[model samples]
Target: METANRIVLPAMDMNVSEGGEIEQTEIDHYVARAKGGAGLIITGACAIAFPYGAASMKEPGLSDDKYIPGLKALADAIHAVGSKLCIQSTHHGKVARIDTANDRPVLAPNPQDYSYSMKAMADCTPEELAKMGAATAGKQTTFKTMSKEDIDWLVETWADAAERVAKSGADAIEIHVAHGYILGVFLNQRDNQRTDEYGGSLENRARLACEVISAVKARVGDSLAVIVRVSGEEYGQEGALSLAESTEASQLFEKAGADAIHVTGWGRNPFDNFTDGPLPNKVGAYVESAGHIKKHVSVPVIAVGRMLPDVAEKAIKDGKTDFAAMGRQLLADPELPNKLAAGKPETVRPCINCYLCVGESFFDDTPFCAVNPSLGNEKVLPLRPTSASKHVVVIGAGPAGLESARVLTERGHRVTVVDKADRLGGTMWFSTMTTPDNERLLRWFKQEIKRLRISVKLGTRATGALMRELKADHVIVATGAVRPKPDFPGGDLPNVQTGDTLRAMMLGTATAQEAGFVLSTLGKTGRLSGLTKSPEFVRQFTKYWLPMGKDVVVIGGSLVGLELAEFLVERGRRVTLLHEKQQLGLPLAMPRRWTAVKDSEAHGVKIHRNVKVDRITEKTVEWTEGGESFSAPASMVVYADGTTSAAPFAAELEAAGIAHDVVGDAGAVNYIHGAIHSSFKVASEL
Candidate 1:
């Protein structure tokens, strides 16, 4: 039952299983991670009572022998790659949508009023809601409070599931007692309210979980390691489990035959506080709690929640936690452990904390990584080796162009990257100012460009004549999108600025004519000592010395506008955000979108939806909502809209009889996800 290393790939629901059986898609997904050098791999939530108390039909099942063959295939595949496999067993409890679909009441320890703010859902489109509703077959959830007989049935079912795991040849079984599952409900004071033996005190509340754990351990009898997952702390709710309670629960479970404690956290309310726990946005999210639990337990403690390699290495080195579970990071690049072992951390792709992957899981769909196009379709999307080497010219230095160059070079092609901008990471570099997680990705691309030693010609725009002169066998156009000026009145005013102009100003490349008085000051002062080149320096430098006035108005409330509004509000500006559409943050994933809308509102960003801009003056912005006109005082007007996909060189290349492929925003504007995925697809083929 021993693993080769301390890195653990925690369970992340692929939602690709079929009727409680593990499909090859799910098997290949885990196999990829094992091949990438992870020491331990945990399967996504497997139903102990398949299709009965299950959340989704797509989750793997261990309730019957029919599922054993699929499980065995997965175990054998992972073991052959020198990695240990652990199966996470659980009954989804009140969150089990399958029961509701079948008209059976979802089981719970107690029935109480449960509600959360729907404000976050205000930005979700109808299509997204429909997909999410399809998980439960459009049925409303109903609850059934568990009785003593039900408890006995659950305990027996858990032990039976453990037997199935042992027969499947897995090294471990993780008992689920966290994230508001059946056992977690019995452990948390907020969910369990029974006046009987299973509730009323800490020991009573922990009794059901301990009974399940002990039953599973006894059933498996040292044949499999028993890992217990618990929420070290519950957030955004009163009476939630605290560190003290969870530490004590860990000790109690240890006494109840648990082999290890895996510490995770829950936000309680998904719509309002998801980023605070579960899959947190913060780095090293649950390390402290896991450390505290480790102090009181003899078994190894596993910490999960945004455990980046550096953070995990430091935490383990300092004796904070015995293992680090990297979930989304592994999805971004399964070979992270292998790269680290090879002492090439810079070569590992980073998860940008975009929430795109988890957002798909909310709809009971397969999650895909933005950086890794081969996430779910591992076998199908492998990088193919080219038959012969050829010179390839990639036009642009952004994420798309850089990625295209990197992959082309790897496939035995000589590549030269040409960009009009002086540096790499086109708009993505500018994006780091508002989204810091993007910085890691930009840095990764930079490192790759340098490590591969691809010839880069910056500040040099590609032309038809230039392409012919370079004599490249092929060309990839990733020049990005074009941000046009607004057509509305006052859009041409001196104070009004588009995303491109603003980026130029921040980069110290904008002329005095392009930048108004307030921003022109930045170009002069920020360019000194190479300060403006660094996004971090510019982020902090602008906080105190930003030239903009207090009151600002931003036109458009899509991804860029929403994030910009939030950023401005953080910098102490009163921002008025206007959108002509009903839903804000259109292309952003639902979870991140919900959090961004909540955060923008929380930061006092005045949001006006379904509005048409009438005009903009130097001192104010006028807009009409319904039949009424509204005005907001604005000293600075930012037109964060009118961006469209454009590749002006495509026609010229076509006429010259040059073979070219258009990718990224230049082909279609889907932002970073589109840029990376499109680049990978195009480059892999060439």
Candidate 2:
């Protein structure tokens, strides 16, 4: 509680428990972050009673003393490293996402008619819509208003949890009253319309929150800190829960013996929640919420939502909040605080705020982080140097290759990474260009590669002789995925190129091979023929886009195709995307897909879904949609669809008798999450 930093790990629902008991996965997880040096680590939001108002299935619970042993295990593990622990106690209330009531109505202050997911149904495909519906199926969508006895009983349950939290050796207890949960709904005018003394007015609405705080404080005395987290404003209809109302509530909570506050807000749009998805900005995503609360609350305050160290430090200095609560950032790099303290902040890995962490929770409710591969499965993470160090050769310099080389070096192995492209980032160069948050990560990877001093051979392709020449004890093939090959008729036409090639060409940074292919096209016939020999001349020459004309038809509906469509549309080109899916970008991360879909639609790029391509000619594409054949005019056709891996080097490595493991897209077309996580796991073992 007293030593290293002011950063706190806020409570997140990482559904990893079994029947309300902690698993080793959860233990290893908190212990790793505790060991990595967070000042205070809060356990995932633990529910009080079961069978009603539960936020998630298998959420860690404290309804009975029988659960204390598991809670004690987590608290002991966190405290073992001299870090303090805080147990977050909550009741899901109306925002309960699970059905624990055995088909009985889920209790709430009033009828809980709908969820934020319901609002997006009109915009989603049937599959996506079904997912949203399934998320709330039997989910206590309607509520019977809480009676005075029910409210008092819930407060008692909260107090019981607090007492158990203190008994379990935790240093504090945080009451979750945010994100449209029970207490948060009670604090909102839009949700609570009862005329009783427990509702209808600001003071009456705040009474329940104050009572919970008082009850918890009475149980813990001064032995534990009492923290209350709240939504600074309801994001639904205006005047629901205004800033003034929240400030008043904060004051009431302080007067009721609350020790601190964590300020976050609900979603204005269903897609724009407390999570990172659809958030217009990355850093300081919710500073205003916390800052407003700090002005009226005498106790310490914490702020979360993608607040990096620099912004966090500034916020604390400016008294916006006493501590910056980091959720995803700590998951991305547990050593963030250590790096900042050591004045080595540049090495700290950043959270790209892709919402994969949050999205995974919605899907499987597991402990997963896109940037950090070792979150839930921390037992497999290496803690010491390997027993024996050997030379390791990694092919390709994409995320997979570099991650393998980095981890292999950490295990005391000598590593050499080779890539055919001159740049360090493979397809990420194009990806990072669109998502600026990833650009920083790209720079960090490049910097780490330099810092590690691992030998890198860019623009060097590996073959059998190269593998045999290195004589490595192990070889890792990360020769990442290539664009899907064109398989339709007329695919071999000169006017067709893949998305990767087109992106590189448009950026004036085409690979050596691609440059030659483009330059050779104008040779022997046009005035620009000989200019291709000069790099600058050719780069400047291609902007006129000799091979790719103004009107282009991009074929494919995968993420690649959608992103390519976004890029081309932004560049002021007339573009159309043809794919087989009913909706083009349904499977991408919420934030990424939202931006791409909006950008593509706003630019007037036509999307032809469920289309069948019959043939592609030099300047035209023939396709059929809804059983009607139509011909689309095009100057060039870019292929972005396909999920296949092509690693010609595998045969060479096999013939050379080199021990090799294929990873990333080379083994199969794994996305970035799968590619990076599996590569790190494999490299850690080597």
Candidate 3:
């Protein structure tokens, strides 16, 4: 039952199964992490009832012996690499879509009464809503209160599932009572209103979970270890399980023979409070809760929720928790553990915490990492040596260009990266001021560039002559997207700013004329110096002093615009955001996008959608929506729009007869995710 180390890969759903059977894609996904040196690997949620109580058809199942071969295959593969495998067994109670699809009422502790806000879905397109609806076959969810017989069936089902795990040769079986699953509903007072033995006091509410844990342990004996996952705290719901109740529950679980307690948190409202729990956006989210539970229970406590390497190491060293369950970090770089063990932690690619991976699970689709292109599809990841190494010139030192150079060097190709900007991370550098998590990625890329010894030419713009002089066998143009000034009336006002101009002003790359008097005044006040080059310093320094006035209006509400709006609002500016379309945060993943909109609104950012800009005056922005004229007072107007894909160098390379390809925003404007994925695709081939 013991693992090689304290690092555990907790259950992260990979909706890649086929009718309750585990496919090789899922197996390969786990195998890659195992090979990458994770001490313990836990499979995603496995339905004990299969198609009957499953959330999606892609979820692995343990209802029948027919599924044993798939589980055994995964177990054997994980064991081959000296890592222990733990199968997470669960019954997706209220969220079970299969039950709704078959016109069978999904099991719940009681009839559902609470509902979450749908305002977050206002920006979702018809296609996105349709894809989410397809998960449940477009059927309305109905629930049936679990009877006494139903509770018996559930306990038997969990025990049977654990027995199959032992038969499949897994090291442990994790009984999932967390994240609003079957046992979780009975554990929480918010969902469980029944006055029966299963749902009254704290112990009564914990009865079903302890019963199932004891049953599973008895059935499996010592052949397999038993782990129980519980929500240390539930967010966005009244009367939900708190840290105190969950800590006592952990003690009860230990008495019921749970060898380990995996502490997790749940956000009751998926749309509004996702970042507050489960996959939390904050670092070390549940470490404190897990540490509290550890003091009450004698067994090991596993803490999860953005458990990055440094956070996990400190928690373990300080005896805060027994193990750190990393889900997204391992997905970003499966080699994280190996790299850490080798004392080369800088090589570990960091998960930017963009929520792109978990967003796919909302639609019942396979999750993929933003930094790692080969997540679910791992077979395509190995850096195969090229038959002939050639000199390659990658234009622009942004994410796309840097990633291309890194991959090409791994494939034994000589690469030279050239950029017009003085810094490495083009627009991504500016993004660090708004979203600090991006700083980790920028630092990682910088370290990789230094580690790989790749040639980088900053302040050197790429051209056909430069490529010819370098004698490049291949050329990759990643100059990124173009942000032109809007063609509307008064768009050229002195107080107005475009994306390029805004970035330049923030980075201190703009001239006094381009930045106007306000920014020039700030520069003359000795604020713009060598220290301003650090995004961290500027981000903090701006909270006290910003060049812009108190009132600001941002046009366009997409990813960049929304983030900028939030940033400006947080900086004490009365911000009004206007969008031409209904979607506010397009191209950002659903969860993160929903969070951005909700947070911006909560913070008093005035958001207007489906609006047409009529003009931008010196101190006001005029727009029309639904045939109604509207105007907002603004001291500074930022036109964070008119961005289009433009790779002018591609045509130049073409005319010169030099082999080349376009990647990143130049090929299409998907931002960072598109940048990394596109660069990897093109670079791997070259």
Residues forming the 10-long window of minimal summed lDDT in candidate 2? 524-533
Candidate 3 similarity to native, TM-score: 0.98
Q: What is the C-alpha local distance difference test score of candidate 1?
A: 0.91
Instruction: Please write out the lDDT profile of model 1 over residues 95-163, one tens digit for every residue.
Output: 898898888999999885767777777788999888888888898888898988999999999999999
> How many steric clashes between backbone atoms does each model show?
0, 0, 0
- Per-residue accuracy of model 3 over 1-686 as CA lDDT, tens digit each: 77888999999999999899999999999999999999999999999989878988999999999999999999999999989999999999998988888889999999899788888889898999999888888999889999999999999998988888899999999999889888998999999999999988989999999999999989989999898999999999789899999998899999999999999999988888898878899899999999999989888999999998899999999998999999999999998899999998888899999999999988998998889999998989788888999999999888998899999999999999999777789988888988899888999999989988999998797877888899999999999999987889988888888888877776566777778867865543433456656789888988998877899999999999999999999999999999999988988888889889999998889999999999988889999999999999999998888789999889888888999989999999989999999999988987
TM per prediction: 0.98, 0.88, 0.98
lDDT of 2 by residue, 326-380 (tens): 8888888887877877899899988876667766555435857766887777766
lDDT of 1 at 183: 88
Model 2's alpha-carbon lDDT is: 0.75
- Overall lDDT per candidate, in order of appearance: 0.91, 0.75, 0.90
> Residue 321 lDDT in model 3?
98
Off by over 4 Å in 3: 517-529
